[model samples]
Target: MIPLPAGRTAPRTAPVTAPATAPAGRPAPGSVPPQRTASGRPAPGAEPGRDLFVDVLRLLGMALVVLQHWSMPVLSFGDGRIATGNALAAGNMWLVTWVSQVMPLIFFAGGAAGAISFGRAARRGLPAPAWVAARLRRLVLPVVPLAAVWLPLPHLLLAMGLPEQPVLTAARLAGQLLWFLAVYVAVVALTPLLVRLDAAYGLRVPAAMAAGAVVVDLVRFAGGLEAAGYLNIAFVWPAIHQLGLRYATGRPRRPWLIALAGYGAAAALVAAGPYPGSMIGMPGAAVSNMAPPTLALLAVGAGQIGLALALRPCAMAFARLPAVSRVLAWTGPRMMTVYLWHMSALCVVTAMVVVGLGISTPEPGGPAWLAGWPHWLLLLVLALWPLLRAFSRFEMPRPAAPYTGGTVRIAVAAGLAAAGLLLFTAFGFVPGPAPLAGAGLLLSALLLGRTAGPARRNAVPAPGTRR
Candidate 1:
């Protein structure tokens, strides 16, 4: 034993450790939260845990999404109504969109997360349906707060004598991002099967999907079947997601080389082919690659996937920094909360600037708006943090453990979530009979009979752990 210093206690002969307990049987697909370790340290050699690279990629995709929404026209008040449109359509910024339009990478990261989650669940004897139910719960829980606020909010605004058009437009923007949520859920539902296909078919699965997308685009353009273009919603993104599936299976053998080639190919197509260079939709553009997800979008998505993989090492290294790691660790679990509330924050800040403060909206393409954007973005971020802290808990609740019946029930939930999100995306959250119906469906899916209130303590998610 070592001698004690002045005013210090002597060390114990042995360091006390947490008593090891036998692993329990697989949870019966309940809505249980994560349990903390008794020793105040994560399990030793926990199975690989979450891949920091994937988390970093998710954060990047989320940041790009935030920036895209932030930069859109806050309030185009000159037309006698509160209107909004993409500000990126202005000036020489078309090239900048090439980098900003990284939505496909979101699905890419999602695919990786899905693959990892499914694999763990399968190992733990968790049934496929329950795993999916849990997965959808994570996605759906965050939307709960947003929907709770917005479902009745539009009606309140209309009753308060707000102008119809401005209210409607704001309603529209509020739910537009739900389109991504709907599509991403579709991709997640397919993950279990996609992983199996990847295991069996190797690279051919992606090749077939890519080829299918191109053929669909041709029919859409040549045969004048604009409806066929919508089919790419199913085709194009899943095709891009396949790239992620391949990556999950240890792919992009030479990520650097692939990134260069893919990017060069996409650029060439946009410059010379039928595709426009802009990755996102733009006003008055005859052929927006994004709207229909043309082959050009796929080309760009391929490039982005390659770029992400190539940068994985760097991103991982940066994420490990002491300060950066602490920030990320704090915010990681609350990411969906930030995303859900940001647009609401934008709406609030926009009104404060335009309506409350009497500052008119700058012209979309003018120099004044451009000069003021950085300042406006800064204000938005500052105003949003408090809202995020207040609302983030809704994203993860301390509800009684949740469980589902069978595959049929899980499928129904997914269908409801997708349909509800689609309605919000296409029609917006207008205070109308039909819109209210959609909101009802959304609420039902989120509630899913969540009888228990959320606990203030955060749920711990560990490696190969179920949340």
Candidate 2:
């Protein structure tokens, strides 16, 4: 077992080492947060205390999300319209519900990583503003190009006189994905406060938040306003965020057990019909299990986190292989890019299958032929991998040196983002079509301005850094 660092009262634990020649740019087992310093370099190797299992958790969660979307079958209403009434829609909803919580797991993992990364940044004297900025850059950068690519797609369809509702639905879906970015950005912004809470009171803060979330759910389920459920976004997600902090600090004696209880409780809720069994969507159901996030979803997130942790050993073992390591190393850097591009890839594939291939209707339920569908799915997955790989560069910061800008830039950017959201909601600004051409334009501009050239110059590693 390795000796624990000073100020870390957690028990000593076995070290998880990296391969002898782990990819050059990868952070060490533990290093200072990857954020850039005033000198525009990442802090040198800070601590060798990272858990490879956590990395695998993030990777697996995203992969599951991709699979879930890929397996989804397109459905249409009786009049050849795409709506919620299609027969196959129910099964699709069920499948999505089963796996929807995977994303919450990803959030938990991210929270934990954020906690650890922030601590490392503080140790190296990186200021709070710089830390926040770095994180925002990483999150927003990859989204820029993706938004740009799709900005004109809807307009093209509308110009061709496509049906209004379908065009609107696709545009809405694009915007829905952006919700993750908004929520995640909010979480990252609150990291400093969350870290302080953890440093002072340990898990109690998060535990309270989680309890509050459940209470909120109970109220919402029992005659409270439906929109009240959205409150859990702040309460429950942050509570899970705290769990990530616990993982970073080594405070929990048995994190997995707590996670198990959460899982069981969630299962019970769904089984009892208080909440839907599927965490995704359900056809013919008035309310989606995910629309406002029930307490059961939180429980599922907890369970998923525990499961991921338990599988850490296997992930670490696999990551040790040279060939495996190479793939992991490459993908790890571009995880954000893969996530941003995957939905678009699905749209592309769906278009090819339906329009180009003259397959008017997607197979109902699973693939037309179960075994054969698996092979087709595999091919689709492989086909998308290269495209995802090519897009990875958009996610990485530029290699140039840092440039100075102050609060003005930030304020302006924030104002634009808010204004953009307002316009989108008020006018039903379609991200794709010509009439709503500027729907995502502001967001695109902000993202590009912050990601390209000088913005990227700040991403270099600090002197003497080993990770």
Candidate 3:
């Protein structure tokens, strides 16, 4: 969700080096002066100043996601292979997913951030296709470094006499995280249209989407057609995304009321309907609120949006503190980097502890686990630090000549990129033609993004290299 500047080559920490406010006559670097409508309110998408609330929410949600992923796994090694279980699968532990499943918040933040970004682009006379292309490039570039390392890793491990199952497990888990990026690409591509829909219909847009989600849930549960549930991917997430669009216009008048209504509906669904209580999928659970995204999850998402809005003042206040601001500045640009590579870091630590040292995870909620949790967390941070340092640069690539192509070609390019991400998510980087094909599609997308207007020097630099 970080809005990386184009062609930025400054040190990674350069983003927040300046004071938040500038002298009387001069605006601070990267600060947008507010543009207001006739009502004396900031214009939609033209709200001046950094959205401290959105930044904090995105960072906190991502951090919690990383912690949850790292802590949930209970690994056991035997017979030259590894088996994995979820610590959260234990009795009554599902309650925690209500708060820990933060994707709704992430999508909300993305919607607000995308509004601001596209607003700025429109004001600068940039077309929608150009803006979409730029965002697509940013999304795809980071994945290149991931693919470069992971595509050949399983083969090397197998050649090194490592067991196939363990190696495949590690590789697949690493790639599975790309599912977010795939869904996000589709959302980004459609934002220009979605924002316009928001302007025209207000809450009705999301209301209609929510109604569609409920009907899809009926088809999924009542008719026993599980495949029908996936249709909510269109209805549910964009509905949440629409709420974010509404937020961009103004803060909710009574967020606590919104929160009460949302959570109340979610609770009703779980208690009286077939929906499961957990927002995330649990091992061995007959119903998962997350994978196919039930109406229960949408209700919880609405509640999360309201809860976050209610806390915005306090969160924004804390985000402005000198210490917190510095952390946000450094971490903001690397949010996507951290999201993409955190699982890889987990893979590394898992290998070292479970496969190498022969240490298996302790029992969930047991005395040993309570005692060892801090040590486990420390190891993960240690493993992730070097990765953050190494791959963070890909977050900003030098600019390509603005994709000067018409909308159709841009759509094609974005489609190819999404397809590539889906390939990685579905087939994984397990040694074979799938990873190679994914890499090719990504490269082809980049190549296709160039314009025929000027002499093309392979417009985009290779993903991880400096020009």
Candidate 4:
């Protein structure tokens, strides 16, 4: 979910390995070759060229997430409560998530981008603590505006005599989306260690993680230890992430074979095992493939990665067209804002159409629903545009003075930020102190990331070090 540059195009056959001129003429795992411009010089610092395939995948994954969220949700308001149901819960729609559920791809792309970016910083002598601090700032800052609005808005709405249930619903739903951020925070915080492990062990690291996931699932299912399922979070996401780390340094051989094997494994899991067919959770289902993400989800993720590799040539070609380039460039910078607020946009549209105007949603798969879908999408877009404009400024964090903080301080800052996001994920911004406390933690983390003013000026005297 990390925001990366998206404008520049690279050759469709861009090298995925370190340059041949490097010592030993063999690229080290997790090392990115320096990118060059057409004139054979390094690409500009501010706008270094990006892998077109990764950029395209990131944008497309985000777009699909938004579309799926916007299009689902069957809503109606009555008795001071807004009833909700999933349109995708309707028959046969669950199959679509195989392609549309792109969280794995997002994390994969993030890992790839992190690998390349960290490699470049390492080459330039940037410390690990400083790199992690900068990444925390980018991930946590955009969330400030979101918290500011939500933490107070619920209280204000309740004071105005609005129904408590609906207000609380919106608040919880808003914060629930932060689960991704919380997990990603942990992922990013551990990136330095993970990258090192990847460099040393290569595919063996992910292979080990996958084995752990299989063990967890077996223990979980066999013993009926539902709580034990959460342990897979440690195993599942990082395994997929390691794939991205590998892909950044080199393409896989026979990617289509991977796709075949992955899909076959997933099909077997769903058919012969307890896993559900849907990648995303559905209401009233006996089991959810998503809530604790099963082995099936990981299998499907592998399939998606392999499929993406198989289609890289065409995807990059399509991404290079002038119109597509413009859209990618424009959306890239603002993608974070769009993601954070898209649900809020859904709430606004829901309130206006369902609560204010008393318009109930049509039944899924009905003609009315089919007809109203486009207009519903248009209304959501209308609601979202202003939000995009208002909050996009926070997407690019204000550059902080070079971090003079120690590794412990950087680690603490990251911990505080992750804790805050986790708090929101667990207990949302309802009319309570949790939201305020979460916001305080985030601000504290940001402060810790800053350099000490007087101390830096007077005491920084090391040779070759800047105050």
State which candidate has the highest TM-score: 4
lDDT of 4 at 199: 72
> Model 1, residue 182: what's the lDDT?
84
Q: Write the per-residue lDDT of candidate 1 for residues 63-130, one digit (tens) a residue.
A: 88788878866464544366556677777777877677877787776666666566655654656666
lDDT, candidates in the order shown: 0.66, 0.57, 0.78, 0.77
> What stretches of model 1 exceed 4 Å from their correct place?
1-48, 78-80, 361-371, 399-404, 446-467
Candidate 4, poorest ten consecutive residues by summed lDDT: 5-14
Candidate 1 vs candidate 2, lDDT winner: 1
Q: Please give me the total number of clashing residue pairs in predicted model 2.
A: 16
The segments of candidate 2 whose C-alpha lies over 4 angstroms from its true place after superposition are: 1-50, 76-80, 83-100, 161-166, 360-367, 375-379, 382-390, 399-467
Better of 2 and 4 by TM-score: 4
Q: Which 10 consecutive positions of candidate 2 have the poorest summed lDDT?
A: 1-10
Residue 422 lDDT in candidate 2: 37
Off by over 4 Å in 4: 1-48, 452-467
List TM-scores for all candidates, in order.
0.83, 0.76, 0.88, 0.89
Which model is ahead, 1 or 4, in terms of TM-score?
4
Model 2: lDDT of residue 322 = 47
Residue 363 lDDT in candidate 1 = 76
Q: Could you give candidate 4's per-residue lDDT for residues 1-467 as a string of tens digits? A: 23432222222122222321335643333332344456876443212245667778888888898999998899999999999999888888988988988998988887776666555555456677777776777778889999989998988999999888888999998888787787777787787888788778889999999999999899889989988888888888888888877776677888899888888899999999799899999999877777787899999999999999999889867766656766766777787788899999998998899988989999988999999999999999999999999998887654454467889998889889988988888888887788888899999998997655533334422211123
